[model samples]
Target: MMDSNDTPVDVRLSLRVNGQMRQLDVPPNVVLLDALRDRLGLTGTKKGCDHGQCGACTVLVNGEAINSCLALAVVHDGDDITTVEGLAGEADLSPLQAAFLEHDAYQCGYCTPGQLMSATELLSNRKVGTTDAEVAEAMSGNICRCGAYKNILSAIQETRQQHAGAAID
Candidate 1:
């Protein structure tokens, strides 16, 4: 509906989430995090601080990681968004997810989803080198108060190596 000034009264957003199309009619003020969790029931994307600084609401928008809480859902219309839940296929875990488990990267697991999302983006981009310091710096945005940085770095590094090996095979 348009108002007197020819402005839209309601906004309809459509996005491709995890290779699936989703539609939502939300107000322009609704944030992407809220729409993903509250509207779409994709709760894997946590809302730790609700502020962009926390990085708990990290998600991939068009293959790039972004803090969903800081982006409006309306702005992401027509974008391809991927959450943590979409990282794995129906019967398998993503390499990063498996590596996190094998490396015991999470403690309390509150930040695991965000960590996985960030790492997924990083690994897919292949811009971050296969080094502890490089992985740590790339993953610095996602904070794990549990202080499991070593294990997290290990997981990311291992996954990178595994993917590289698979590519070679």
Candidate 2:
């Protein structure tokens, strides 16, 4: 049936967000970032550059880091999506979050959520090395307008070292 006055068809997506399964009927054109924020009320994932040029909307899709703004909600059916809210424990902060606070990795705090999510993936993937330059290059997609690159790098490195040390114990 073709009609000029018809609205776009809404597709049902079953997404596991922050360890909870959620069902949503969203339009095919709805971006993952909008779905997470507008529909699920997970506002921790910031919307910086909607075009994916900025990494403010970064989130973990099945443990891989991706820009939420660039992904369509309909395409992520049955996928695991982790926002910044998922990074912390029920009573305490994750190691990375704690490191960010200890290292003062943020200035304005607007980009911190995306920065944390991206850092979590980077640390877990073993793609980033134990160097400041490597961390910077790996995190290049995230843009912190306050220019807290040094502190962010420190937090990532420290968290990595902590995990490495824990592995030995």
Q: Give per-residue CA lDDT, model 2, range 1-169, as digits (tens).
A: 2237786778898999999999999888999999999999999999998998889999999999999999999999999999999999989999999999999999999999999999999876675687888888999999999999999999999998888788779
Q: Per-residue error at 19 for model 2, in Å?
A: 0.4
Query: Which ranges of candidate 2 are over 4 A from the true structure?
Result: 1-4
lDDT, candidate 1, equals 0.90
TM-scores of the candidates are 0.92, 0.95
lDDT of 2: 0.92
Score residue 57 of candidate 2 by CA lDDT: 98
Question: Can you tell me which runs of candidate 1 are displaced by over 4 Å?
Answer: 1-8
Model 1 scores a TM of 0.92
